[model samples]
Target: MGTSFEKVHDYMGRRVRGLWQRNGKFYQQLLVEQPDGQVAPRRILLKSTTLDNCRIEMAQKRGIRDQGEAASEPLEIPSFAVCCRRYFDFHESLKHGLKRQTTIDRERWSLNRWQVHFGHLRVNQVTRVMINGFMQKRLRGGRNPRTVNIDLINLRQVLKYARDCGFFTDQERLPTEGVKPLRYKAPVRPLLKDEQFGLLCEKADSSANRSGPILADFIRFLGFSGGRYKESLRLKWKDVSFELRQVTFGSDGLSKNGKARVVDFNPALEAHLRIMHARRAPDCKYLFPSPQRGGKDIPASDLRGSLFAARAEADLEWVGFHDLRHFFASYCVMSGIDFKTIAEWLGHESGTALIDKVYGHLAADHKRRMAQKVSFSLAQQAASPAEQPAVAAVQQSPSAVLPLPTQSGESAATTALAS
Candidate 1:
């Protein structure tokens, strides 16, 4: 077996970072961390040679330091099932990359289903055709493309590991080379309206199970803060800094992108937090302590059961915990908050990409009102200074220039032109 020594170059003849090519096949060099806090260089074969894929993998593997030191390479070739287990074993020993238990758990979930299909086959026997068949079967069985793509991702990682362990010869083609993820539009979920939130709180407050009031508080907390449910579940009372007018989302690297963020107080979030603090159980550390915690102190694991009841009573079957997050983001947009600032509050990266795509939907009335604010030309640019008064008057009295849009949404100018 040859050590990865060749540095790969893109079409522009520029040297790429941590990317290497040998014999027309591309591989990415990763610094996998050992349990003892030292990192070891492990060059893994890529499923595809495109720079985009390499960059995506690189981002996911960031933060592990590489000192250009080589690690002991595994020499064992195993079945797909064994490879899956070993893959997890390798991640378990890592102090850096794949360090988050949440990410590992998600990977395990995806790989478990993958192993069920390819477990009996040897690592080398897993081919592109078989992978396509599995994906087709999953889609036929009513699984969405997003989930199927996740399965493919985990499988690709195991295959890469198997290749590193000398499972594949140099001449054989990578099985995942031609496989593309299924394209499907992400559905835009409806946000929880202000009135609906009030109704939900009312229903929750009236619950007979004594669980209703807590559920109301949970709703308000999420609705105001735009927090992911899991992050909010772990939020402690001490994380709240009234002096700073903000609540930190627990320890650093606890968020989705693995960074701690403090949500500054809005009127609703401030009011909700204060109310919860006043009524909080004295011995509890978490803001929302579990009523089930008799002796052992712990936060409530979930509020789904009570949410189901309140949702039913409020007749809002489409509402979800994440909808509260959408509610916060959408309302922020409506209030003229910038996407970058909102993204910071929500812990999103890459500027306003995710914000503009997912949470930027505005209410119809809001959109219409904003549409009224758009001007195609500057007053000075559009006309001479002497004519500016007429333009200004026309702008101020839009109905005089052209009658307002009618009930059917046609302007009087259009009506006159038609006549």
Candidate 2:
């Protein structure tokens, strides 16, 4: 058959005239009549070869045109404030199971600052330049790089959620991806000295404050176990195995890494835990019961206040509760325990890189003691010069020594020896 042409009609009965195939190639043409009644033809080369394929292509084009027309009309996009609310709602939904209340609270706090600045704008209108401006404003307001980076991270999450929900067009880039976080150096928070720890504990025990003894025990427990503040505070009675000398950090996202970990108890921690366990009330489920809140886990705020008072009284104002954990890790490293072991004990899922970065510095006394252990010299010999091999060789060989080739292809014996 000669190259055939056909008219294709869409569902609306609008016919696309110039649907034809020649030499195994299909073509589509649209003829529009102008206001003056002159016809202008617009041609599109369709890659299909058969008449059926041409008809299908024509239908697809019509559907795409309809979609384009619909897209051209205005559609309401939610504002940044609305997206923030939705993000917070999503986070709140995940609370009590996948996420902790404290985590959600922090996210909300970080995103609130964003809402204050970008709330009026739609999610798609928050561009990278705007984010960069926000970062600059934060930095100008005396916020640290780490804090600003956290804010950016929170904003990024909200925007991503909006994009995924189809509030933003696919072509829009996330501001978070375009903005780079500022680089910052972590401050050095060293471990407390033995005498300092002793003084703090002594002061804590002697203080008239009701939380004094609790603070002392908590400090010592942290020093012994190297556990995080929340990890130790949330330690349940059932999670501790006194007979096995092991404590498990588990209670649905209790651990910082969101995975359960077992920490072996040393004799010190074991003895202290036993004492606490024995004194614990029958109705109390927490290992460290709150003195103020009866039966509940001790609030961190209480411990923090107690810790501050104890530190002041003991003249260890620089020592924080986290220092106790650092003290534990420092001792472990000085005792020749490998970083991998320390990381595992600290409930780190990743290996020793973090441990090495934070706890790599050894105390001066420990360094000096280590230095004394390294010796290069051997014991002095009682042999006389005549008994020494070098002396005997020089006396016996005098001028009859064989030349040994040197690395430079020269005779070693030819070079004069320094006296």
Candidate 3:
């Protein structure tokens, strides 16, 4: 066996800040030559305030051999497996501070699932046929088209990386180019006005269950305010300035979208919140605490559970916790809350496009209201004083009048003839 040694490669690519950053740092990768003669390259993620030190430290962590490691037996070409590992490592390395690890984890899971399916094959072996076949297999097994499309997206990224690394020369396009994603139509089952009021009353008065009342109030708060589930859970007592009657959101624990919105408290919701506030611990900060008693915010599972239980008690069906969001917008339209204000409450981008796309029908009633207004305006125009004077003038004129024949003249002619 040749002088056995581990080889390391430091990828001095882009420098960026991430979750674990003091200031800025360069990323590193390591490849080891096993005694079995298989060369394996691995990425060791590292970030430091100084890029220079990060490079040096990355090299040091590569292995003990410093001398001919770089030149000795140029590290064997990495396999598809190694390539994907590097791709994720690169992705994690460039992660921005605002990016949530949950999102990264979800993306990583999708990528790795694809890898497990086909990472063993050579990069060049991947063809559109192979991709379509895989998708067909997944779809035949009852996977939703949306899921298959997600897998396709993850594969596209992998193939792109392979092309970039010169594994294949097909610069023309990705294998997924011709693939069309499945269409998903959002279900349109908005709560009727009476149904919404009934649900709220049920939540407020559910005395049978320990968790029902708190969960009910929280749900009602969401229904009334159009706040996201996580936003509601993350709400702090400080966020609500009862004096100003304004509720501000927390900067640190804002939702995944990183948006904070305030809702002008309706008198009803404000009263309910005040009652909940009185029960809140002075030091225990969160407006909604986990029933288990030790967490920053209530677990999503609890919220889901409470929602299901309340729905059961209220005999309401087909409405999700998020449907409360739709309910809010729909009720807003019914109550005459303007779309712009409703969008702001829902944390939507300004403009009717997204709002209309998601809840266009919710605003249908508004369209009807507008139509009614137009009809009323036209009716008033037809009966206005200006038109009335013209009608009176026509009625007063003889040319516009019709005369009736006189029956008395006919009767007098008949009498004269008899005489």
| Global lDDT of each candidate | 0.78, 0.74, 0.63
Per-residue lDDT tens digits of candidate 3, residues 54-100? 65655555443455444222323345566777666676787454446
1-419: candidate 1 lDDT, tens digit per residue: 25546887778988988888776676777665433346677676666667878777555445323333332322223578877777788988887755577788888888888778877787888888889999999999999998898888877877888777667876767698778988977886776889999999899989886677778888899999999998898888889988899998846466787788878999989988998998888888988778688987798888898889889989998898989888898899888888888988888877799888775556444776776676746643666555555446545665556445678876534453344
lDDT (tens digit, per residue) of candidate 2 on 1-419: 36555555556767646675455566676553322336666455675766567778766665554565443212335678877877777767863555566777898889889888888887788888888888899999999999999998888888888877777667867777858889988887656889988899899999898988878888888898888887788877888887788988755466776888778887888888888887877877776667787545444345898989989988778888778888998998888788898888887676798887776766445676676555423321343433344334554554446457578874433342222
Ten-residue region with minimum lDDT total, candidate 3: 16-25
Candidate with maximal TM-score: 1
Off by over 4 Å in 3: 1-81, 90-98, 157-172, 192-194, 200-204, 243-245, 264-271, 294-301, 335-341, 349-351, 369-419
| Prediction RMSDs, each to the true structure | 14.5, 13.9, 14.8
Order of the predicted models by lDDT, top scorer first: 1, 2, 3
Best by lDDT: 1
> What ranges in model 1 sit over 4 Å off?
1-75, 95-99, 164-173, 361-367, 371-419
| C-alpha positional error of residue 46 in candidate 2 after TM-score superposition, expressed in Å | 28
Better of 1 and 2 by TM-score: 1
